[model samples]
Target: MSSDLGRAMPIERPDPLALLEQQEAQRLPWLLPLRHSRMAENPFAFFRGAAVVMASDLARQPHSGLMVQLCGDAHLLNFGFYGSPERQLLFDINDFDETHPGPFEWDLQRLAASMVLAARSLGLSEKQQSRVARRTVCAYGKAMAEFAAMSLMLMWSAQLPMKDLIDQRPSANLRSYLAKVTAAAQSHDSRQAVRKLCEPDASGTLRFRHQPPLIWRLDQLDEIWLGGLDWHTWMQESYQTYLADMSPNMQHLLSEFVCTDTAIKVVGVGSVGTHCPILLFRGKHPDDMLVLQGKGAELSVLAQYVDLPVPEHQGQRVVQGQRLLQRASDIFLGWYTNPKGQHLYVRQFHDWKASVDVGKIDADGLRDYGILCGWTLAHAHARSGDRRAIAAHIDEPEVFARGVLEQALELAELAEQDHALLLRGIASGRISST
Candidate 1:
């Protein structure tokens, strides 16, 4: 059956280098070296940056054929804590750049494989790594079963609070670690972002500080890069289009602020080459400031594999997918296309956003974190997909869990080989080492 729980995994082997090269062809040429350098760090790092490769591979694999809005890159690193509209700290999937409606298993598989690679990076024993991987899969099955019986409103309003997560810690050390992460997340508000990225210029105006290669003001770049256009005018036009997309309340909230400065900021391993502009705005009061990011959005890699409809506007696709998967989304979330036809989604640069430091977690902590991530993924899927069908498919929980774990292990092995291939490509000069 297409929705069978224990379908055999596919054995087709695609060329990882080919897929990666294809993806690189679309990214900024200057940033490809940085992307390559970052992915070269380790298997886990490679896994995080190689979503397109996995998407290509998963397309050939057997699936339940149950479709859901996927967090296309659901690796552990992408799940994080952020402040909800109500100022509550909620743990959920944070990145939706590759999001699209596709096979439910694609998300689980990516997440499971990530667990395996992450455990390996942490120097966990094979047995311990297998345990962590299995725990993540089992947790998903258990959580989906619970969600299957939930009322619509109950499911909609449900959130995993930070305190509840901390209380579930397997040991005192893990609990202490979570406490520190939560504290850090709580402190990562707009003020901290401003302090880290902004300073008063000689004219006494708060402006973004210049950081070359990673961040810089548009004025600092040559005319050739700017295409002889006025930076301020171009930025203002983009800002107005973004403002027009916002709701009246959001617009009114933003109306109190005026654009102070804008800069080209490089962000994330996968998103490094994209057009990410940080816009700083100041409100009526001297200290009142807001930072917004205009991030370029491209079509999801899943679109090539699935028979999904091509999104008319890539930015809107990201915004819609984010709203579907996240329990609460950024209030300032919106989309606009510039005159150059570049699709971009706008949101607060940082509003109490934080992520777990995977390296700091011990074996016990990894297992607990894996379970939390599984639960979070299940919740997101349950909200957007048919939970009953998923629950029924995972009817025999242990059996389904075992199946997922086995497949994850298989895929992780493949990913390791792919990582090796990348290293060889770099050594052979087929790929850049920079």
Candidate 2:
């Protein structure tokens, strides 16, 4: 019988540099060089930054026609540990900048390809890399099957605790590494973030430390362009608009805080040039401060390929996608369009959020981590997609797993070639790195 699973479709590959140029047209010019530098680091690094490139390719492929609210840029690094509203540490997809409704296997393909690239980066043999990819596919298949049989309430309540993940470490070295990472994540609260990013000024007011090209206070900009108003006044107006979207209780809680400072914070490879501003607020006491990130949101790359409704506001689309996919999300998550018509989403910054050190993980550890990532992706998809259909499509787990593994290997090879092309572009000055 013909199968929908892993069907190869014709692809008219776009010129990589031309696509890069198209994306660059939408980003801040100064930051493109930094993005290029980061992407040039290695194949895995390029994979992290080339979500649009992969999305372009995936758009041409035959899909299973199974749709889910996709974590559009799903990769190994995007899976991380963050605190739930109740202060429980849970592991899930932490980045949703490009999230939207798309073919479910698009996410699986992105994640699987990431594993292969990451494995190659660590100098793993092809056999070992294949093992990791296979394990990931199998884990996803099994998890989806489990979700297919689970009660709705149980599925909604389920979470993968950080402690359980650490305990599942395959070796003593990995266990010790995870323990340290977990401890660091536990201590990475808002206060810790404030301490790291902010310092007391001469007047005793907390101000963000100037980190040239990466982080800077708004006042440090060459011009004050907040509609001819002062920084503080503009911030207050923005806060009120953001506050309007919160619940009554949350609004009351937030009302107790006063805006102190705001700064431009450049973050992530794929999100480098977007407008990301960190807002600082002081609560009842000086020590009680909150740092919230306002990140610019734009149309998802997948939007071009799928026949979906254009979101009235991209920020709202991201916020809704995050709520649907994550078991628990940041309590303060919201969105609003700025006066300039730019869509931006707001969330508490680094409130006990941390990511595993992928560099420290050995081959066995990578395999284990892949399993967790696969299972987490499965859960997110099961929540939003028809789990029964997904489970049925993944029939004969081993065959599906092998097919995915082979596809991942092929994609990895292609990614390496693309990485080389990017490097050549940089060297030949076709792509600017300065």
Candidate 3:
């Protein structure tokens, strides 16, 4: 009874500001202001950036103990569309920075809370928000039950056909919205990225556009930031190490292109202060180009709570987690160590990758999208966890949905209070806001 979803809130939790500042200490100092500014935009944005806060809070409460490879930060916005290795467009969990094996319900609870926050941001009524959140858990229970009845291999190989699901939507407006998203996602590739992010230098060499604190070339940084190491040598060594882990065919395919540029690229709400760099490569043909992104990997937020063996290389842990949970992962997914001995994972950049805008959906659209996300999460959990046990645990879908909805509503209130705390911290000079 103590593990009842409705009763899962911790009686006492750490000061959110303290936890935030402690987490920020590990990030790039200069980018802390940007992170604060982004989180201050809205409560949902704060929720997006505060996975550590959630992890800590969730650990203080009782859990179902049904472990799976969590998306780590399974917020609604984290689900998206990306091209598979065979060029098929697919939909599933897109972020795994906090990924580690943990309670299946932790992910479900996060997804539900995100649904409520996102619905509120979209101006949905309280009833509508509750409907969306409850629908997500209901769908998850149903999907897990279905997977529980399937053969192991069948469940493992199952993929969500997002296009077909969209087409099946009863509302024409929702279909139109999803169609636009799919169309936009298809065009979100390297060529589109090149148009937006690249410009020719004086020597007619294509390179990443120099955009100050957000995007910059290595040479653009001051010597103090460079710290006397040669980035050119570092890039060469890091790139080679990344390639060594790739399959022979991929390595051979990549060898056709030469690295032309690499730049410091900042992205995402929670990931703002981490090391993210984008690379440009060009082949013999003038039009042939590729872009790859590298993101620094830290130990999962769940790492502190779970007693699992720590991974020797954080990047490898991320790479392995993505490969396991995603129906089809990026073909070039790999990892390497930087000159500073930090671990980073690499994947193709903007290769038909895009997320639905949570702010733009109506009540019906939100409910539909939540169901899809729930089903997708269930599919992922079934592959790496015991589907039958999970299905049996959440046996009464309606009752379980109500309890999870209550938990989400409570968490949303906590998030709002935490968001206010952040605002007060910024005003008081305890937290940075630039």
- Choose the strongest candidate by TM-score: 3
Residue clash pairs of candidate 3: none
- For residues 1-434, what per-residue lDDT tens digits would candidate 3 score against the true structure? 14322234447788998988887776778888999999999999999999999888777766787888888999999999899989988988998999898889899999999999999898889999999999999999999999999998888888757768788876576678888888888898888888899999999999899997889787676645444566676678788889988889999999999998888888999998888889999999877889999998988888877766646799999989888899889988999987777789998899788888876667888899899899999999998798999999999988999999988998898898999999999999989888
Tens digits of lDDT, candidate 1, 266-378:
89888878878899988888678889888889888787677666468999999999999998999999998866668999888987898888888888988999899999999
- Name the better of 2 and 3 by lDDT: 3
Q: TM-scores of the models, in the given order?
A: 0.95, 0.95, 0.96
For candidate 2, write residues 1-434 as lDDT tens digits: 01332334345688777877887786766778988999999999888888888887887766788889999998989998888898988889999998988888889988999999889888999899898888888899999999889998898777766677788767666678778877788888778889899999999988998886789687776443455666676677777778888899999888898888998788988888887889888998767789999998988877767776646788889999999999999989999776566788999988778787778989988898888899999999999999999999998777898987777777788788898999999999999885
Candidate 1 wrongly placed segments (more than 4 Å):
1-12, 223-227
| lDDT of model 2 at position 123 | 95
Q: What do the candidate models score in CA lDDT, each in turn?
A: 0.85, 0.84, 0.87
Ranking by lDDT: 3, 1, 2
Query: Candidate 1, clashing residue pairs?
Result: none
lDDT of 2: 0.84
